[model samples]
Target: MRTYLDYNATAPLRPEARAAMIAAMDVVGNPSSVHAEGRAALGIVQTARARVAAAVGCQEAEVVFTSGATEAAGVLDGFGDVQVAPTAHDALWAHHRRSEKGASIYAMGVANSETGILSDLPKRDEAGWHAPEGTADFLMLDVTQALGRIPFAFSWSGADLAVCSAHKLGGPKGVGALILRRGLDVEPLSLGGGQEMGRRSGTENVIGIAGFGAAVEAAMRDLAEGQWQRVEKLRNILETSLEARANKTIFVGKAESRLPNTSCFITAGWKGETQVMQMDLAGFAISAGSACSSGKVRESRVLRAMGFDASQAASAVRVSLGPETTEDEVLRFVQAWLGKEEKFRARSAA
Candidate 1:
């Protein structure tokens, strides 16, 4: 009877990913070992690498596996002067360093997790878009939120480097990748046994990598089947139902291009955390904002960046859907939330 709607935080693990991980559990060899057993393990990692590369539209050699997107972002350190979008995820935003009027690297996310807003990358120019001459301008895109929910290709994304997480796309957690353009190099974050082509040196998470490959294949299949279009319809239905009943509600980023599964709405005088708790108790799982920022009583930076005042930013709740979400579940959630909104309105009027 419980409905799960917080997909932007983490997706339910795909069955293909689970099965692949279970199968990989039996493989007993270090990928760095030179023996037959080791070679077999190496083959698994290589195959997964190729699948991941194909999913992101990059060369296999360009992909370097990491613990997750946070570690992937660390690889970009010391690249150059760093500039970040205010709407970027905290992981990418934490790496920002002000540029001093010269060559600079831009780190921005393709999508905002809280508001589901999509950002257009800067156009390519002879001077590398926004940087000055005699400097190698680099663009780093955080594709963690955009990977499976929307169509993205690393080669066509106009990025010198891109990072994504496996768990965000139905793959196992703790496994992610950094995609670098061919012939571009970054200093190694970990130096050990010269693994990951010496870019990231450590024993690869063989089972997680296997699951990541299977999940990417399955996610692509779902995209090709137009499953997200159906999810978008469900999202619109949810929004319409809520808007019909609530008088003072605002849908964030309604006028912008967004991920089909995401809907972030705000109701004045009602805090997002309280609504999330009420929904959870009523058998629905939702979020006030990014899962990373959950439990913190701070306003959404993305909403504030979009010109929303403090109250609206703090009152926002995000309900993200998935292919498995049903129309009945969406309706039920709408009804439950509407009931709560009524009580809040009554108290405000009182």
Candidate 2:
């Protein structure tokens, strides 16, 4: 049986989400139309907007639906003076670009992929341009990796804007949200007949939105029920096993507060792609660093930014779990991995 473990890339559709999408597919009406049919579509879109808004603990009006997190981050360009975590998804990379020279550049640092490291912003700013006691428009958090697994509130975090992907939390792929604090002007990325409150204009994907809503509902329920505890247990088991068998392996991004499902590490003398391929051949799927560049042959920038040497950076791999992962799977992977390591060592000696 094939084991799918690459959750950081994308999650499988939840059953509730699939059912919701299937049901919504039957409703044939353009949300923008003023007729009864159009009104029905509009109602569906509004209901989804409310559900998604509630999921993130924000007002429905604050949530602007987008094609995905990439587009969501793109919207942040309208707001000048952007600050992002160096560990943020590539979508937020544009924050590095500013119209004027010497603009504030803040690259928040995280501890690890799974265990998020909180930035020492106050410490990092001891010299000048301090974020006033509790004010400033200098932050836009990319919550794509932190959402669902962590209890993050945009309002509480002091972020002016936040981006989250639905699929990361078992939602549909084609839908995401760009949440901006009140009064922050975000110019539209796509223009046409005004939709998404004149922010994103296009034909609405009612079915995908419905599924996205259901998935968010499920994730929220899971979070409330302490379901992450189980995943954390599996994660620890994997880490312990790695420690027992690998001598030079080291975990990366050990954040003080991170998404519980993520764990990135590097093993000396072994390339990440080779390990990933071997894992896949053994019926387990894992990522060689970020899945965003899974096919590309390059060292992980995140590791290099953290000061790892080129070889260690090239050796990093990410083993992200999901809500569906089981303890048995972790045990099996550990056992299989230990056996592989012994064989490789013997071959090296010969």
Candidate 3:
């Protein structure tokens, strides 16, 4: 039987999300129209928007719906001087300005998608300078991986802006949002009939947005019930078992605060790509690094930024579990992986 453990890449859609989307499929009118059917469609959009706001801990008016996180990254495109964390995801890092000028905007992710390492969120100073002042120095959080897996509230994160994707939290893939601090204006990337409070312009994806709301609400419930803590225990068990068998394996961020379900480990001389293939053949799903880079065979930029050499970076693989993952499944994966490790060591000795 195949086991799926690549939640950092994308979560399996939650039943709540599925049901919401199916119900939204019948929304026939355009939300922008003034007709009765249009008002019903608008109601769905507004309800979903409110759900997203509650989950994010932000005012409902601050949430601007977008196609996905990649498009949401456009908030930085208009700025000529910006700094991005070395380990930031490509969506944000792609906007990095390398001209050696001082930055007025900084972009960083609260959690590393590959290693699952958690980072401190920005805090406002006494002068309220934490929020960007007229495109001046400020912080933007990429909350994609951290939103559902951990406890975070944009209302108090001290960040000027944040971006997240619905799929990362078991919602439909095509919808996402940009959380803008109240009273901070940003030029719209796509200009048309002023929707999303005139911050984003486009016909709403009714089905996807409904799914996103349902998923976020469900994720919030799981967090309140301590479901992630159980996942953490299983992850620790998996790591402990692997360490006993593969003495040379390096578990990244083992001592650091991290997402409960993620484990990134490096086995020198054993390519991560190869391990992923081997594990896939052994009936498990995992990843070498971020899922965004498809058909590319390069060392992980995230690890390299953290001072790992090319060899170590290329040798890393990530295993991320879901709330539904059972201890038995993780143990089975551990056995299959250790078997491959032994064979790889023997081949190197030979």
Candidate 4:
């Protein structure tokens, strides 16, 4: 069987989550209505809200369900001066970049996507005249990649808004949540028949929501029980295996903490796309980086912003692990890489 290691993209639905979702699908009603059926659906939504809130260590009232993280980010970006990480999901960057004149906006550079260097958070003393203290009108964190698989304690980060996607943590797709600090003014993306406290309007996707909650709960349970350590070991195996193959190979984001399951690296003299295609043919599923912009020949903005030469940035590929990943699979991947590296070096020599 082919090993699956692209958890950063999306995870397979959990069995318990699947069953909960199936049960939820049977209850059909518009949550906006005051009738019995509607109230039942509303109950599911509230329960999910509490569960998700619990997962993220926030209040139930703070969780605003949305179509997904992209929309969630859009909702938060509507509020104030938007500052986005250069390596953040494109949705957040695009929204901030498109703001009108007089729009409070600033782009913070992160470590290169190809190099995996974490940028230091801006300091108060360094805020300069251009960006005064508390100048961040609204800070929306795209914690999609950092959640579930890593240690992320954002409660003290002072971020006004944050987005999390269910599918990223093995929950059902089509469901996500926006976590806002109490009393932030945000206009609803969908207004009319008010639902979700007038923030999101529509009949709640009960099944998806339930599944999302289950996934969050599962991830939290694993975190408490130390599953993260096991996963980290597997990831290290992959990292060491890759590093052993060639001297020119470079690992990205080595300076700062990163998700335990993710590894971004470049093979000397080999194009990322070529390696990706070859790996796919070898029955391995990896990424050239960011499912949001896979297959595009454009230079990675995250890499350029982090200061990598164009070629190094262009040749990076990311290998992310899932709960199901095995050491054997990682070994096989490294063996394949060694073969590919030899061929690539031979061709360059000619």
Q: Pick the candidate with the highest lDDT.
A: 3
10 residues in a row with least lDDT, candidate 2:
106-115
Candidate 2: tens digits of C-alpha lDDT, residues 1-350: 88877887788899989998998888888998899888888787788888877777677888888878788878756654555555555667655554453334333422234233444443323343344233233565567766767676766665556677889889899888888777766688789988888888888888888888888888888888888878888887888888777776786655345567777778765788888889899999888873454366567766676688888888877888888999889888888777777776777678
How would you encode candidate 1's per-residue C-alpha lDDT over 91-189 as one tens digit per residue?
Answer: 888877765654477878899889899998876678775632223388888998888778999988878998989998899989999898889767886
Residue 64 in model 2: shift from native, Å? Answer: 0.7
Q: Score candidate 3 by TM-score against the native.
A: 0.95
Candidate 4 positional error at 6, Å: 1.2
Q: What is the lDDT of residue 206 in candidate 3?
A: 87
Candidate 2 lDDT (Cα, 0 to 1)? 0.73
Q: Model 2, stretches more than 4 Å misplaced?
A: 80-83, 101-136, 347-350
Where in model 3 is the C-alpha error above 4 Å?
A: 98-103, 122-136
lDDT of candidate 3 over 193-302, digit per residue (tens):
88888888889998899899999999989989999999999999999999999999999999999999999999998999999999999999999863456657578999
Clashes in each model (backbone N, CA, C under 3 Å)?
0, 13, 0, 5
Q: How far is candidate 1 from the true structure (C-alpha RMSD, Å)?
A: 2.1
Model 4 lDDT tens row, 198-310 = 88887678889988888888887777788877887987888877677677888877546766777888664477778778888888877674334544655556666667777
How are the candidates ranked when ordered by TM-score, highest leading?
1, 3, 2, 4
Per-model TM-score, in order, reads 0.96, 0.89, 0.95, 0.89
* Distance from true location, Cα of 115 in model 4, Å: 7.0
Candidate achieving the largest TM-score: 1
